[model samples]
Target: MAFKEFNCPSCGALLKLEYRFTETVICPFCQQSSHWTGENFEAKGEKVILADYGSKFSVGLQASFWGTKLGERKEYKFKVLGRVRFEYNDGFWDEWLLRVEGYEQNEYWLQEDEGEFFLFKKFDNLPSVNEYSELEVGMYVDWEDYKMFISEKAKAQISGGEGELPFRVIPGEQCDFVDGILLKEAIPVSIEYLPDNKKAFYVTIFNLDINDFVFTEKKQENVY
Candidate 1:
């Protein structure tokens, strides 16, 4: 079986175009319609290609420690939740510790250039952590209440509003901490295969405006 990539116009979800007879497929994330163009389907749009995991990191299974103080520096302690092999640079590499947090767990599609990552999710009723257990990788997630985390310094930089800034203003999103922007579209995905023979999970997302999406690696901390 072969799979082609297709992006959802409403929710920006990445879908695998498999069934040619399936003219319309609803996006799992946003519940949006992804209609197929009968004629010149190949020219309709472009497909997104992902990268392979390399040999840089080792994969294992363990628990992770997360800490968060409303107005202070956040800290993270990853305790090997599980191990998974990531295909990178044509070869496979193992990631020993995978951190799982509400916000940090969202899944994102990475581009070949490693420059951007796309966040994909539906805006319907999002699931709780317990509910998240049933989700699989490459599946749709609801992004309605997802929040973004930023550092104190980042927040201060925005408040001062005195010097030149590097990031653009995101609409309808709140600024938390000192240096972070919050969005409600973050969703988690299940991670397959670990050293302990257990399963781990992470979050992924898709970008709407930008051609590419990138996730800023943040310290994993407990939300509440």
Candidate 2:
């Protein structure tokens, strides 16, 4: 995909497309939401400009790390393309969209909350459930022959976002979520329940070491 630039419809502030799959963009200049239609930005509602809380990650930042998958470790590089903040009872967490180099699936999510980090990749085969009301903490789910136990069930509201995101972020939208842990492998599982009964599943890495990542100021070449 080629890199593209366009002006924000709300304020005419210049913005560039950081990833190929962007569906929503938050203008840094005007702090408003815009929908991307492959060619142009359509102005939408206003979005909050998240205050700097001294986070180590930011949109457009690049890093390389030794990431582990299925007990195999390999070096990988990725860029921070966007972020969405979710507010729950405990406070909030930032979910970052990353474009990882050399991965079969280029996009992944890195979640940070209260100084703890987790890396997650989109997972198919959502658990059998009609709604969030059916799930409770400690409920057992038999998924792919693995016995998983629900660890958390909560509702979180979308607070704000930055840069380019794969999905549209509607501020103040409520999201119901169920989190489980695969007992045998000790892997985490997450399911986000959206409006219209749409759901998203993710395979998570719990407590990923912060030291494994190395951030850089320079942009990676050939990202396009």
- Could you say which candidate leads in TM-score? 2
Candidate 1, residue 192: CA error in Å? 9.4
**Which candidate number maximizes lDDT?**
2
Model 2, position 224: C-alpha lDDT score: 38
lDDT of 2 by residue, 61-109 (tens): 8787787777888888888888988889988888898888876265588
Which ten-residue region of model 1 has the weakest summed lDDT? 156-165
TM-score of 2: 0.87
lDDT of each: 0.30, 0.79
State in Å the error of residue 173, model 2.
0.8
**Candidate 2 residue pairs in backbone clash:** none
Superposed on all Cα atoms, model 2 deviates from the true structure by an RMSD in Å of 4.9
Worst ten in a row by lDDT for model 2: 215-224
